[model samples]
Target: MISVGVDVGNKFTKAVVLKDGQVISKSIVLSGFDQKQSANEAYDQAIKEAGISKNDVNYVLATGAGKKEVDFANDVVSEVGAGARGAVYFFPSGRTIIDVGAEDGRASKCDQNGKIVDFAVNEKCAAGAGSFSESMARALEVPLEEIGPLALQSNNVIYMNAQCTVFAESEVVSLIHAKTSKADISKAVHDAIAARIISMARRVGVEKDLVMIGGVGNNVGFLKALGDGLEIEVLVPDKPEYVCAIGAALIAAERN
Candidate 1:
């Protein structure tokens, strides 16, 4: 059976094609103003890349914040549910799934079968999510991709006191004016975000085989900070951001 999964996120759209429980193709694109349009484009791109006709797809499952916008989807799955299913695909032993998206973060507890048992989310604030780092990177006048390596060079421990994104941006600016090194400020930003996410995850009870899947999972600095905060080695899939889409596709395949 062949299936497709579309993850319509706040800032991006991801799609994956799954055939017989294996991923055949995946695509990612900026969400832009029209989420539905972006989702369709991502799906089309995935099918094209897989060298298959759209008519060959058995089912289409949608997940993420904008899942409802995917008008063509046969079914919808919650982000946490998708994350649990997706993380387990990469690490069969994964018991804790951490997902940090553009504007929110979620932690899901999963059983051996990748079914969600419990979950927690930090959706009301951006301080614990990917946006925090993007905003902080802007304040430091550094490219988002460069922040990771720069943060790894930090030699001093600097703590950020703000928990609100607006306040955090102000704090970052102040640090810039105070002659603080960019590396130290960057590390502080990642550490602060990591601390908030870790606290949220602990409430749901973190377990062994911790796995992280999201756009922020690709950030080396953030990953290091999160792993250190949890005092465990965090596992991230090769395509961390596409995990949700992969899970949705798997669900579609199962439904078939």
Candidate 2:
């Protein structure tokens, strides 16, 4: 059986095609101003990559912040539920999941079977999410993709005190004006976010085989900071940002 999953996130839409319990293809695109359009584009792209026609899909499931906007989906799943299932699929031994998306961050404790036990989230602000780093990179006049590598070059760990995105912007500017090294500033920004993420994860109770997912998981510097802050090895899957969509596709397979 072939199944498709769509995840409409705040900043990006992700699609996955699963066949016979394996992910055959996936696609990601900026959400832009039209969520539905982006979802369709992602789904269509994945189908094309898999060399499958739309009619070939047996089921379609949608997940994420904008999941409800995907009118064509057969059903929808909570982002947290999808994330937990997807992460477990990649790391079967994982019991704790840390997902840092564009707009928010989540920490979930799950069973060996990928069932959620408890969870905590930091959604009130962007300070603990990917947007924070993106904004910081912009302030430093560096590409977001380069921020992680630049941070890795830091010989000293500068401390960032701002806990709010708006305030952090000013702090970053001040640091820049003070002639702070970009590498140190980058490390500071990620460290601040890491501290917040670790706190949220701890509330849900951290356990062995911790996994990190979502777009921010692509940031090696952030991952390193998170690992150090939590004092645990962070396991990440390939294309970690697509994990939620992958989970939704897996769910579609199960229902079929």
Candidate 3:
């Protein structure tokens, strides 16, 4: 069966094409003012990469913050549901799933079949999400892609007390004024976000075989901090940002 999944997130839109439950092609694009347009653009890019036509697809599913904006989707799934399903698809033993997106962070505990048992969300603030890192990186005058590696180079244990992104940015500025090294500030930013995410995960009862999915999953610094905070290794699948789209495609295949 050929299925397609489109995830319209806060910062980006992703699409994945699958054949018989295996990923064939995927695309990611910035989510502009028009979410529907971005979704279609991503889907078209994926279909083109797969060398397939829209007519050949069996089903199209949508998931993410702007999922409802995907008017072309045949069905829709919640972000938590898609995250759990995708995580389990990558690691069958994944019972604890953590997804840190651009605007929010979520932790879900699921059964063997990817059915959610309990979940917790840090939705009120961006301090625990990818945008926080971007803001901090900007404050540190470092490139966004370089922040993770920079953080990894530091061994200092500097703590950030701000829970709000605005305050966090100010705190970063203060640290700079204090003559703190950029590496230490970078590490502190990642550590603070990881700590908040871990606290939320604990509310959902974190278990073995923990999986992290989302754009932030690609951040090596955040990954290390998260694993250290939880005292467990965090598993991240290839193209972690596209996990939700893959899950939606899988769901489309299963539903049909």
Candidate 4:
């Protein structure tokens, strides 16, 4: 039997196909407002890669903000559960997961077997997210990928007085005018993001083998900051951005 799981994250839709409890194929597809179309494309790509027909995918699970857009899904699940499951799958010793996406971030504590025991989330702020960094990059004329690596090279002062996204952007501009290198300003931005993620991690009580997932995990600077603030090394999945989809696939395996 084959099962398909897809995570419709704010910026991307990720799909994973599992056969007899092992992942056989996966796809990360760019998302659109008509979420259903994006989900279908994700599944199409997964099926094509697996050399299977749509009918061969016995069950489908969906999670994340745009999950409902997965018209063919058999179950619509919570992102927290998916993250927890995905974390344990990657690091069997994982006890905590900090997932930062485009609009929100959260922390979850799970048992050794990966069942969520407690969780905390921040849906009201965009301070420590991938979107915030992307916005800063665009305003600063710096590429997103270079934000972290370059930020590490700066020796200037860190400046971000407020955690609000609007205020932070304005502050970034002020720093720029003060002759601060984009790298320094970027590092401060990531420091702010790390603080937010650490705050969330503390809410759930930080634990060993901590896993960081979602789009933000792809940012080296932010992850490094997270590792620094939490005082516990964080484990990044081989595909940091696909942890949610991988977790969904694990859930599908459990169902079977």
* Winner of 2 and 3 under TM-score: 3
Error of 3 at 179 (Å): 0.8
lDDT of each: 0.92, 0.92, 0.94, 0.86
Candidate 4: worst-modelled 10 consecutive residues by lDDT: 150-159
For residues 1-256, write the lDDT of model 3, one tens digit per residue: 8999898999999999999888999999999889999999999999999998999999999999999999999989999999999999999999999999999899999999888999998767888999999999999999998999999999999989898889999999999999999999999999999999999999989999999999999999999999999999899998899999998898889887
Cα distance off (Å), candidate 3, residue 63: 0.3
Give the winner by lDDT: 2 or 3.
3
Q: List, residue by residue over 183-252, the lDDT tens digit for candidate 4.
A: 8898898888888888878978988889888888888888777887777888988877788888888788
Cand. 2 TM to true fold = 0.98
User: Any residue pairs clashing in model 3, and if so which?
Assistant: none
Q: Which residue pairs does candidate 1 place in steric collision? A: none
Give each model a TM-score.
0.98, 0.98, 0.98, 0.96
lDDT of 2: 0.92
**Cα lDDT, model 3, residue 115:** 88
In terms of lDDT, the best-performing candidate is 3
Candidate 2 lDDT over residue span 55-125, tens digit each: 99999999988998888899999888889999999999999999999998999999987889999987778
| Model 1 lDDT tens row, 1-256 | 9999999998889999999999999999999989989999998899999999999999999998899999989999999988889999899999999999998899989998789999998878889999999999999999999897888898578989898989999999999999999999999999999999999999999999999999999899999899988999999999799999998998888888
What CA root-mean-square deviation does each model show from the true structure?
A: 0.9, 1.0, 0.8, 1.3
